[model samples]
Target: MNKAALILALVAAPALAEPDAHALERLVKQDCGSCHGLTLKGGLGPDIRAQALAHYEAAALQAVILDGVPGTPMPPWRPLLTDEEAAWIAEYLLDGDRE
Candidate 1:
């Protein structure tokens, strides 16, 4: 492949490397679990179970995941995730599907 093509491929690699279910599950169980509880039942943060999240809109939850709750322990994950990833996480949480 040409140098320019190689460069383009490299640039596109990260965007293509979206997390899979296993990775997402690990993130939730490890990272989010730190605050939300290992089972996401409730911890320092509020419970984020599917039923608990029923009152929240999916978009609103995605916004919270991306931007975080201001003046709270929740920190914005925008830097660490794409909008799609945030939406995925929000949907995952709402679906109550845990690996």
Candidate 2:
């Protein structure tokens, strides 16, 4: 390939890459954001951005993400999210905690 074509391909490579986190965020917005806000600030569900520190542990968050809490609007996700996906979300919450 020509140098210009190669550079173009490289610049466009990231767009072709599968973004799991972006996909997860889309899913969260679709599934979770009916309650939680788009930014996780708050809605029908408690504010994940503002309150995650007090309400969650990495493990507990993973559990809630994967299996969900009973008797809450939260639904069990055993049929949906894999354990790794749940862990990723928990880590995202921990690392991105707003307060």
Candidate 3:
């Protein structure tokens, strides 16, 4: 393949991976909860409960998850999660039904 083709392949955005709900729940409870608090209430981080996060649209929440807030303890999770996974997390956070 040509160098240009190879570069495109390397940079081309992948389709969002199918999410694993159970695993993602565990990730939220463990990874995100480490800062947001085990119950998603305020801890080292601000409250992330659904009510507290109501102002954030899903896309906005996804960006925060993937890119994190600058100059804050909220570190970027792009390396650890796919776009879809981050989106799923955003939905989960927004969903009142979530545990």
Candidate 4:
């Protein structure tokens, strides 16, 4: 393959690796739970249960996860999480499928 073709192929390739559900779940339960409450009801941060977050679109939730609420104790997670991971977490939270 020519260099240009190789470059294009690489750039066009989708990131095939799905985010680790187990790890993300753990992160949500542990890291997020630390502030959102063990049951994600309410605490120092605020209630993050699915019902409480029904007003939010998944993308908005993902953005909050990636960038955090400025001036709040919520810390940006972009450095530690990929966009895909953040999306997964958003869906997970919205789905209210926590254990």
lDDT values, one for every candidate: 0.88, 0.74, 0.90, 0.90
lDDT of 4 at 52: 95
Clashing pairs in 4: none
* Backbone collisions counted per model: 0, 0, 0, 0
- The 10 consecutive residues of candidate 1 with the worst lDDT sum are 15-24
Superior by TM-score: candidate 2 or candidate 3: 3
Give the C-alpha miss distance for residue 38 in model 3, angstroms: 0.4
Error of 1 at 46 (Å): 0.5
lDDT string for model 4 (1-99, tens) is 899999986886565257889899999989999999989998888999999999999999999999999999999999989899999999988999645
Greater lDDT among 1 and 4 belongs to 4
Q: What is the C-alpha RMSD of each candidate to the true structure, in Å?
A: 4.4, 9.2, 4.3, 5.3
Candidate 3 per-residue lDDT over residues 1-99, each given as its tens digit: 799988885676453246888899999999998999999997999999999999999999999999999999999999989889999999999995854
The estimated TM-scores of all candidates read 0.81, 0.68, 0.82, 0.82
Question: Model 2: per-residue lDDT, tens digit, 1-99?
Answer: 899999997997676454378877678766777888887777988777635655677888888888877898878877877677777777777677432
Give the local distance difference test score of model 2.
0.74
What is residue 32's positional error in candidate 3, in angstroms? Answer: 0.6
10 residues in a row with least lDDT, candidate 3:
9-18
